[model samples]
Target: MRNVDIVQLSVFVLFLAAVTVVGFLAARWRRGQTLMHLDEWGLGGRGFGTFVTWFLLGGDLYTAYTFIAVPAAVFAGGAMGFWAVPYGAIAYPLVFLIGPRLWSVSHRHGYVTTADFVHGRFGSRALGLAVALTGILAMMPYIALQLVGVQAVLTVMGITGTGPAADLPLFLAFALLAAYTYTSGLRAPALISFVKDTLLYLVVIVAIVYIPARLGGWGNVFDSAEAALSKPDPATGRPSGSLVTNEMTHWAYGTLALGSSLALFIYPHTVTGALAAGRRDVVRRNAAMLPAYSVVLGLLALLGYMALADPGVVAAVREAGNPQLAVPFLFDAAFPAWFAGVAFAAIGVGALVPAAIMSIAASNLFTRNVYTAFLRPDATPEEETRVAQLVSLLVKAGALVFVFAFGRSLAINMQLLGGIWVVQTFPALALGVFTRWFHRWALLAGWAAGMVYGTWTAYLSSSPAQEHFASPLAEIPFLERNGYVALTAFVLNMLVVVALTVAFRAFGVPDGADETSPADYTADAADRLAAPEDPGRALTGEGPR
Candidate 1:
C-alpha cells in the first residue's frame, strides 16, 4: 500500500465532513412549505438571488474535472489547453443573451428542463423526448468525470487499495453526495457552492502567486515549460506541444473555442442553474459577474506550465503515467502537507457541487420530460418530485458504475462527447426562444443528423494512446482543415434544419402548435406572478386559466 499523509488526509476528511453536514442542513436553508413539488425541489423555489446564483452557476460550470483536466490538457498538449479560457470568456456573453430568456420562459410556464421549453414551444412530445434523452445521455460522461476528478485527487493523496477496496472512498464520497442531493435537491449544491467556490478561489490565488515565486520566477517557469514542451515524445517523433499555435493548428483552436462556447450553457446543468434564479435579472446579473471565473481559469491553466517547470512534479506525473495527476502532484510537491490537504478538499468538494447539480438536472429532465410526459401524464407535483429525487440517486449511481466500468479514457473524452451531443439541442432550445419558424419535424431531423455525424466522427478519431473517441478535432469536409467535430456537426445540423424547413413549408406540411406567447420570453418575476396560478395547465394545454 502507498503511504498516505495523515495530516493531508485528516484535513481532507474534516472539510468533507463539514460539507456533508452543510448539505443535509441545506434541506432547510430556504425552507418551503414542503419539498414535494418540482418547482421547490428541482429549482430551489426559483428564489435564488444574484449572490447565490453566482456561486451556484460558478460551481456548476467550473467543475472539478475542469479543475483537474484543463491544466492537465495544458500539461499534455501545451497552448491548445488554453482554449478553455477563451471559450469561457465567450460563453457568458451568450449566457447574458440566452439566460434571461430561458429563465423567463421556464418561470412563466413552469418548465423544469430545457426539454420542457422545447415541448411547449414546438408542441411536440417526440421532439421533447429527443431533447430529454440527449441531455441525459450527454450528462452521463460528464457526471462520471466528476467522480474521476475525485479519484484523481484521492490517488495523488496515496489513498489506494486492491480491487473493490480501491474505490471505497469514491463510493463513500458519492454516497454522501447522493444522500444530500436526494434530500435537499438543488438547494444542497447551491448552499455548498459557497464553500466550494471559496476554497477553489483560495487555492488558485495562492498557487498562482506562491508557486511562481518559489520556482525562480515567471520567466524561468515559462522558459522551462517551453523547453520541456518542445521536446519530442518517445511514442511519436513529432514535438509534444508548442507554446503558440502554428498554421496547421489555428483552425482547430478557433473552432474548438467557438464550439465549446456555444455548447457551454446548453448543458442541462447550466440551464438548471439559470432557472433556479428568482428573477430573469438575476440570471443576467450572474452572467455578467461569471466572467470573473474565466480570469481564474486562465491562471489555473498556467499550473500546467508550472508543473512542467518543476522537475519533481513532472517526474511524479510521468511515474504515474497519467496527465490528470499533473495538478494534484504539483500541489503535493509545492505545498506543505496540511495546505495540500486543503487543496485536495477543494477539488473533492468541487466535484461534489457539480456532480450534485448534474444528477439533479438529469433527474429533472427525466421526471419532467420523460416520466410525466409519457409514463404518467396525470402525475401530481408530489409524485413528480418523488420520482425526480429517486432518479437523482440512480443517475449518481450510474455515473459511479460508469467510472469503474470504462476506465480513465472516458473522463478525457467526456468534454467533446458531451459537447457534441448537447450542442445539437441548440436549435430547439436556444433558437426556439427567439423564433419558431423552424418546423418541429425539421428541428428533430436536424438533431438526429447532428447526433449521428458527431458520434460517428468522434468514434473515428484516434490518438497515440487510444483507438477511438480519442480526439475532439476532425477534418472539416469543405474547409479541409482540422476543427472541432461538434462545430462541423453543428453546421450540418443547421443546414439540415434550414433545408428541411424550406422543403416542409414548400410542401405545406402541418407545423405543430406553439403554446408559448411572444411575451413569455421577455416576462419577469412580476409578470410570472400576474400570469396563471396553475402553470401546469399551461404545460398540458388543459383547462382555461
Candidate 2:
C-alpha cells in the first residue's frame, strides 16, 4: 500500500473517468424509438453492425479475468494454465457454427434472452424458466470473477485494505458501472468496448514486447519458469510447471479445454453480445475474426513466465498471498509508472465491459423468464425494460457482495462451478437451435439431473488451498482418471436426454409444439430488422414482452 505512484494513479483515474463518460453517453448512440422495449434496452435495439459487434464480442470474451487469471494459473500450475489457448481456439469454431443461427432465430422472434428462445422452441415455459434460472446463477459468479480482476489491480496499486476501506473503491467502480448500464443497457458496454479493446491491445502488445526485453529474453523467461515450477511444493508434493502436460494431467487439460469451449458461448453474457448484432453475418464474421484475441491470449499466458523470471514479482506475489495479482504486480514493477497506469486502466475497463454485459444478460433472464413468464404475464414494454434495469443494478450489487464475502480464490472457484452449471444448458438451448427432436420434458429432466450432479460433484472436490468447490476437474466416473467435471456432467445430461426422449416417444407422451419454423432459423438481417414491432408486446404468442 505504501508504494503507490501518484502519476500512475492519476493516469488510471483519468482513463476511468473517460470511459465512464462514454458509458453514460452511449444511451444516445443509435437512439431507438424509445428505450422502453427489451429490444432497445436489453439488446441495444438489436442494431449493432459488424465492427461494433467485433469489438463488443472481443471485449466480452477476452475479459480482465482472462488477462489476470490465465497468467496467474500459469504462475501457479505451469502448462495447465495454457488450456485457455486451446479453449479459445475451440470456442470460435463452435461460435461460427452456432452463433448466427442463434442470432437469426432470436432476431426473428425478438428473443432478448436464451431462455426466451428455449421457451418458444420447446413450447414450454417451464423449460425456459429453467434455462433462465441456470443462466442467472451461472452468470453471478462470472460477474464476481470480473470484480476480482478489478480488485487485483486495485490491490496492486495500493488502493486496497481491510474492512470498509478495502471495498470502497470496488463499490465506487461498480456503482458507476451500474449507473450507466441502468441508463443505457447493452449500449453502454457496446460503446465502451471499443475503448476497452483498443487499450487492451495496446497494453498487451507493449507488455509482451517490452517486458521480455527488459527481463532478459523469452528463452530465459521460459527457463526460469520451468526451473521454478519443477521444484516440488511442500503442500502438494508435486512439480507445478512444464512446457507440456504429463500422463497424469493430460485428461484434465483436454477436458478442461473442451468443456470450457462448450460452456463459453452458452453463457448469457456471451449470447447477449452475439444476439445484439444487427446482422446474422455480423455474428459469423466476428466469429472468424475474434480468434485474433486468442493470439493475444497465448502471448498473455507467457506473462506468467516473465513474472516467474522477475524475482520482484515472485516475492511480491508471495507476500500478497494472492496469485491473481501476478499480472498487475508484474506491470507495476516492469513498466514506467505512466505506462503501468495505462495497463492498469486497461484491466479495469476490461472488467467493466463484461461486468456490465453480464449484469444486463442476467437481468434480461430475470425480466423475461421470471417476471414475464410467471409474475406479470401482461407487463408492458416500459415495465419490462424498467424491471430489467433494476435487476441489472441488483445483479451487479450481488456480485460485489459475492466478492466481498468469499474473497478472490472462492470467486475463482465459484466461476469454475458456474462454468459447470452453464454447460448443462447446452442440450436445451444450443441443440434446440439446430433440432427440435429433443422432448421438452426430457430436456427439462436432463437439465435437472445435470445441475444436481454437477453442483454436488463440484462441491465435494477440494484442493490444497481450499476445502470446497476448489477445482473444476474431478475424477472421471469409474475411470480412475481426472477430467473436467463439467464435461463429464454434460455427457451425462445428453445421455439422460436421449434415453428419456426415446422412452417418452415410445410411450406416446406428447412433445410440445415448436413455434419456430425451419426458415426462421435462417432468417436474414434484412428480414429481422425490417419486421414491425407491436408496442408493449413480443413478436409471437405469449412470448417475452
What lDDT score goes with residue 493 in model 1? Answer: 99
Model 1 C-alpha RMSD vs. true structure (Å) is: 1.6
> Candidate 2 has what TM-score?
0.97
Instruction: Show pairs that collide, candidate 1.
Output: none
lDDT of each: 0.88, 0.86
Q: Please report how far candidate 2 places residue 545 from its true position, in Å.
A: 13
For this target, which candidate reaches the highest lDDT against the unseen true structure?
A: 1
Clashes of each: 0, 0
Give TM-scores for every candidate, taking all chains together and pairing residue i with residue i: 0.97, 0.97
Clashes of 1: 0
After superposition, candidate 2 runs with Cα above 4 Å error? 410-412, 529-531, 535-545
Q: Which ten-residue region of model 2 has the weakest summed lDDT? A: 530-539
lDDT per residue, candidate 1, 1-545, as tens digits?
A: 45888988999999999999999999998978888888788889889999999999999988876788889988888998888899988888899888999999888877889998899899899999999999998888888888888888888888988888788877987798889999999999999999999999999989999999999999999999999999999889877788888888899899989999999999999999999999989998898998899999899889999999999999888887888889999999899999999999999999999999999999999998889888888788889999999999888888877676554733656766789999999999888889999999999999999999999998898777777778878999977899999999999999999999999999999988887898899999877632333445455555452
